[model samples]
Target: MAGYLTTHVLDTARGCPAAGLKIMLYKLSGNSHRKLLEVVTNDDGRTNAPILPAESFETGSYELVFCAGDYLRATGQAGDDPLFLDEIPIRFGMSDAEAHYHVPLLLSPFSYGTYRGS
Candidate 1:
């Protein structure tokens, strides 16, 4: 079995998908981080392809940075300074290289949450 990674973003405030949101994937190593990929959410609040394809999947610690504040501001929901939730970073580990990892974010201007999904 081959492993892969995926993600999804939802705008809970507007009750719709978070389109055009920017996402960055980074591989972490000993207090150092290397960016792997950058992607934007589609109309369905998902990337057009997997965040980490099976060919590049590896067992390690990874971080996902989501530009939620910019997204909300772009959608006319947030203003400058003192923004509630800005960039959200999710750090997780891949223990099983053969299992699928789905990180889904349910977000609003003031709050957000994420979990491992199927």
Candidate 2:
């Protein structure tokens, strides 16, 4: 078995999956970040496939940028011009080469939370 990365977003304000949210994956090295890929959440708030599949899995620092502003605006949760929470970036490191990593975001217009899930 090999390691891979997965993620999802939930709209806590609406109590539903954050469909149509855009997410970007980046691998960080020192002061630079190399974009890996960009994906959109489906109706289930999940990507159609793993963000980092085993074929290209790596053990290092990575970031997941969730386009929370767009989702908030689309869902009419954003109240003003400047949203309290916009693009949410979560940075983490993968240590095990043969492990599965699941990162999920729980978001609202004013706040957000994340965790490493199974």
Taken over the whole model, the C-alpha lDDT of each candidate is 0.95, 0.96
* Candidate 1 residue lDDT tens string, 7-111: 999999999999999999999999999999999999999999999999999999999999998999999999767898899999999999899999999999888
The global Cα lDDT (0 to 1) of model 1 is: 0.95
Which sections of candidate 2 miss by over 4 Å? none
TM values, all candidates: 0.97, 0.98
Please, what are the lDDT tens digits per residue for candidate 2 over residues 1-118?
Answer: 9999999899988899999999999999999999999999999999999999999999999999999999999999999988898899999999999999999999999999999998
Error of 1 at 87 (Å): 0.7
User: Which candidate achieves the best TM-score against the true structure?
Assistant: 2
Local lDDT at 63 for model 2: 96
